[model samples]
Target: MRATIALALAAALAAATSASGQDLLLRGGPIHTGEAQVEALAVKDGKVAFAGRLDAARRAAPGAREIDLKGAAAYPGFVDAHAHLSGIGFREMTLNLEGATSIEDLVARLKAWDEAHPGREALSGRGWIETHWPERRFPTRADLDRAVANRPVVLTRADGHALVANSAMLALAGVTAATAAPEGGQILKDAAGQPTGMLIDNAMALVRAKVPPPDGAARAEAVRRGAGVYAARGWTGLHNMAASREEVATEEALARQGLLPVRVENYMSLAEGGEVLASGPSRDGAGMVGVRGVKLFMDGALGSRGAALLAPYADAEGTGLIVTPPQVIAQALARARTSGAQVAIHAIGDRGNRLVLDAYQQAFAGDPAALKAARWRVEHAQILSPEDLPRFAELGVIASMQPSHAIGDLYFAPARLGPERLKGAYAWESLLHTGAALAGGSDAPVEKGDPLVEFYAAAYRHDLAGRSGPDWRPQEAVSRAQALAMLTSGPAFAAGREAELGALTVGRTADISVFSVDLLSAPFDQIAKAHAVMTIVGGKVVYEAAR
Candidate 1:
């Protein structure tokens, strides 16, 4: 592995040296440099030499490595601002229920999985959501124990925010009737007040321990495969949201070994133990697996009604739990500020959003210098009050959102939020109008980690499946150009990598994706069909679909 990375680095340097004097240029195609001329690009030393007239590129970067755009709309390499890579990587390894709509269907899939893997003692799988199904109600422990009797079974909810364990699994975790819910989490109980194996928020850890820990090699392999999966779909770089210290180490090793296909913006959290900054900042990470941010969950998700809301969910009388409380926020912020790390907080509900914004505002208001360099992030930003919309730009925080989520969650959001409060939901364009640079993402496993789906949702403001006629907020929809910037320069800025990656201009990394169809001209639905024909990272072809 060391030899391989050395060889690749040597080749990259050789290419940079060879193209030092004479420039490398690509002409004819229209380029979107995010803020500059929409023309050709001249590259030298793997950086953009010049990006202006076609004639200028030819004159400057002569004899340099060149790629033909072939009339395709060229923009900066895409950056998925938020995603669950470990979840995406391991999705195939588990019982995936991304689209299961019925309890019967979910049970059948799990039964089939258990039947196939005979005598596998403990069984695990994911993908069960009562909200999207015809019969919308949370599944109980009996539901799972019935399928796999005595085996310790623990299946994660579609969103990594929660999980459902069987009787045996609960026993293994020592979760009984007397178990008390942890701060920022609740243990769902049966009618008899017994633990039902339905764990939310911090309660998931109780059951998670019973599951075998994935080895470093296995996780590394999973992450590498996950990167390849995204590259094949036109993703040049990605934000690995809420990763453990060990996962970051694995990705770092993979990148150092030249096995990483995608540029990862690693956001760390001290999940079970170890300090994120100490364990990570120890390694500067160069540009491979950069750990400059920390992830904090302010509240739970909207699907499970665990998302903290000012008012109770219209569907459920209970209000959502506030996952990360004030004290926790202050404590984490202290660590982050001291460690010189930016923070990314997950705030989905109104109260959650308000609280996170308030905490950040207080942190900044306390010492303006603290935020100048950190560039904190708020993941999801799913639902927000109009009053709190501009808090992002005001505090210089980035609203790292997943466009696919707006449309995907719309089916049930309105039902829970009611018509009165619906105005504040999925307000992407409003955030932009409020002067916030939106960073686009897929949120992966939670929602399919497809860049195109994100683009469709952002630009068109509609679902690929076409749930609503036009879009939820058609007037608020962002133009393709604006959406492109969110996925590119916006995230680039978020990661503090604007100068190096994102854009395809001179003095920047040569990370590019060539799509089969022109992104600008492709019809709405055709986008989902469009695939990345060629993916180049650091002037090397990482993925190219076979003709």
Candidate 2:
């Protein structure tokens, strides 16, 4: 079945190619083939036939159509190891609060959105961080109510683990001050014990359940729009974490129509792991979509103090909340194991990471060989103790991570987690040195889903402005080469796709990311400012910057 899908996809790409056909010669100044230097590449039937000197490439594919890169550098098309495919599209289509600088800014933006789209049953968006706001606190439900009264509104924090609901939204969810928080969630209350409309982790689901689900048309549009956004930034593929079954079907359906611009590995939500497994591993349409993994959340994020932590947060009064209990994690892992599906669990804090590790171990203990082969991952393996750092490689688990989280979290992590615990936070280098592989991502819609931003964070270990302090942990900074690997091969490994993707090797898909500057040797600022000149997926030019 997999072979059939691969062939079908190749045929689709071949059909898309011009009269020159499937044979092509691509010559560029420098090509980072995830190894030694390469000057040119030959593509045949959407796969790399050769990657070496121009003469050798030409010899390998005689009479092939030629494309001159004109001094641009080529690298493996980047893979976002973790991100929400549908959410990114929705973010573009809905009210975007990513730029709101304060609570007032956020409310103002919501008001403007309300005015623009009057009579909306609900106003939904993401990308607001209260940490950077002048108020330095989450906005209450009253705040949102004041901006757009009567209509329900729910705006997610940048971390995606929490959201502030307007009074109407709260009422729709039937949540009030008297309503107790869920097992692994919180409903922030006022001094007088009135509901604040702030929901964390499981609590957010209450109001979220009431939001109208997007129709098929909306999902299809999101796929098209989001693909273009990633392609423009040079992404050849992305790991769609927490994709619903409907989303998986939507992407596959789009792929069938040759509308999918990039490859997608759909990690369907673990809540539906059984159904995904029953459907089995399959690819369809342009063969640009794959369904073989499940995404599970073990805890919330730190910004909201919902991430399960071993110790109480320095600024908050509690350790953290475990969104998914240990027993549930164990059961999910076991179920995923039976289906031979890869599992990626979201574990953000020390306690969360610890519990997930335990669950994975317990599930894998029964069948050691299966465990070794599963390539199971812990998404956002962000915080950990030194004792648990080595367990990743030891257990053969991949650390699916997002570097953007580090720079964003650095702003307030010091206050949330004291100086002592800071060392174990965002320990990228530490995890690498311990023999664990790191898969880089942006967690898009949660952060700016830009590969350059993620690379800057990993390579520089500082905020976007080059700001860093003792607590920023400069020692964890990785070399640029390492950073690139994290974005490319690292993610490929996590997806179990290193054999065919990640590198510009012979027989691999001709997916390439062309940039204006060499990311490895260029100045830090140039690397940051570097623009993608072109992006090719399966040897087909998906994006080309205007000359």
Top candidate, metric lDDT: 2
Q: In candidate 2, which residue pairs get closer than 3 Å at backbone N, Cα or C atoms, i.e. clash?
A: 256-285
Q: Taking the tens digit of each residue's C-alpha lDDT, what string does model 1 give over 356-472?
A: 888887776777656756788888888787788888777777889888877777778877888766777878888899898679998887877777788888888777765573326
TM-score of each: 0.89, 0.94
**Residue 158, candidate 1: C-alpha displacement in angstroms:** 1.8
Give the alpha carbon lDDT tens digit for every residue of 1-547 in model 2: 3243233334333333322235778785688888866989898888899999999999999988887888888888799999888888787888878868998999899999899898958889888999888897899888898898779999998888899999889988999878988898998899999989899889988999999987889987776667667776788899998887777777776666666778899888866667765544556645588886788888889899988889899997998888876777777676677777788889999999998888888887766667768888999988898799999988888999899899888888899989988889999999999999899999998987888888889999877777786789998989988999999999888877899899988999888888888888887777667777777888887666655
lDDT of each: 0.75, 0.83
Candidate 2 — which residues are off by over 4 angstroms?
A: 1-21, 278-280, 366-369
Per model, state how many residue pairs clash: 6, 1
**Lowest-lDDT window of 10 residues in candidate 1?**
13-22
lDDT (C-alpha) at residue 144 in model 1: 81
* Model 2, C-alpha of 192: deviation from truth (Å): 0.5
Residue 66 miss distance in model 2 (angstroms): 2.7
Q: How well does candidate 1 match the true structure, expressed as C-alpha RMSD?
A: 4.9
